[model samples]
Target chain A: EADIYQTPRYLVIGTGKKITLECSQTMGHDKMYWYQQDPGMELHLIHYSYGVNSTEKGDLSSESTVSRIRTEHFPLTLESARPSHTSQYLCASSASTGGTEAFFGQGTRLTVV
Target chain B: QQPVQSPQAVILREGEDAVINCSSSKALYSVHWYRQKHGEAPVFLMILLKGGEQKGHDKISASFNEKKQQSSLYLTASQLSYSGTYFCGTASYGNNRLAFGKGNQVVVIP
Candidate 1:
């Protein structure tokens, strides 16, 4: 019942197009994160939110921007998509407990041509 | 900083055992393990805290060494379902921002 969800499991957009990846969690978690990963590679954190109205850039610098308007919603937007932006985007959520394990969404695969 | 995983790939037969190691350059507060199937997001397996203890999930187990800033995951009596990419994510200040290591691909043959 309680879980993280990502919309548009797969997306194919042309370069220069604006795209938004939607992430929502019903688990009532206070911490949410977005990670970008390539096939067979490690996941790189691109954005994170401590709570509603709180957003921060992650360790890996990304061209995309994220906004947290509500506790359950965190969306990532790219003004001009590029081929290099094509990758799997994963959304995760965790409670405020320092040692709590995070739950991840199914992920969205974006492809830019 | 990102952690480093050893033995990028390994193959094992059903009922075999294997160990994957992950080391971080910075002091680690916790180590998390996850398994990702082909074309899917990773599923959390377990988390080991700073006290250097072991945690288990089914036939999978892991140990964290806070002093060494390292962790090791062990799979005993492997099964076909265990075939996937294993990733170790470390956090210096708990779960705020995790730095993942290069995944270790495990293939368990029947």
Candidate 2:
């Protein structure tokens, strides 16, 4: 079945370290998004891509950046990690932004020391 | 802006019923619902579009109120499998982006 996948279900990194969270979808969706959530907190949109070569910052200001070089892959990178960056990062994809249900990946839990 | 969900948390016994509401200040084109177990990704439950369409899986139904820019998920005869955090996502103006509510935690004890 078509699905979204995120690598490194859990990650532990030290401060100032660089890390990349990989998200890939087999559904061939044009719209992709990344969300951050802390325990018992609401999900916050951090980054999104409309299509390949198109990326935008989301409602929440995040230190991470994402690239959409291919339709199936949307990866988020943190140039420098911090304790505050520790949270669950969720990846989602939809056929279109106009109308459709999003499919989410298992998610990556990052622990920045 | 994020949508508001009522009843931050609720506990229910098996076979009981409950309703979770999601409201948005902005006009909505569609509303989506999902359930997430602890440490798991949120799974799509249903979606309600404009024009008063209602949809969901077996026993789990939902309704949308276009006028109120809100939606409600109704759980009838709850089951242990239904115990999880429920979230409502609203998208407006055909925007691909969805604003999700904080989520409602539901626990069904047998």
lDDT, residue A111, candidate 2: 99
Deviation (Å) of A52 in candidate 2: 1.2
Fnat values, one per model, are: 0.62, 0.52
**Residue B4, model 1, lDDT:** 92
lDDT of 2 by residue, A1-113 (tens): 44999999999999999999999999989999999999767888888888999998888999899999999999999999999999999999999763688999999999999
lDDT tens digits, residue span B13-70, model 1: 9999999999988888888999999998899899998667999999999999999889
Which ten residues in a row are the worst by lDDT in model 2 chain A?
A95-104
Please provide the root mean square deviation of candidate 1 (C-alpha atoms, Å).
Answer: 1.5
lDDT of 2 at B50: 70
lDDT of 1 by residue, A1-113 (tens): 33899999999999999999999998888889999999778899899888889888988999999999899999999999999999999999888533778888999999999
Instruction: Rate residue B98 of model 2 by lDDT.
Output: 72
Q: lDDT for each of the candidates?
A: 0.90, 0.90
Candidate 1 chain B, which ten residues in sequence have the lowest lDDT sum? B91-100
Best-performing candidate as measured by TM-score: 2
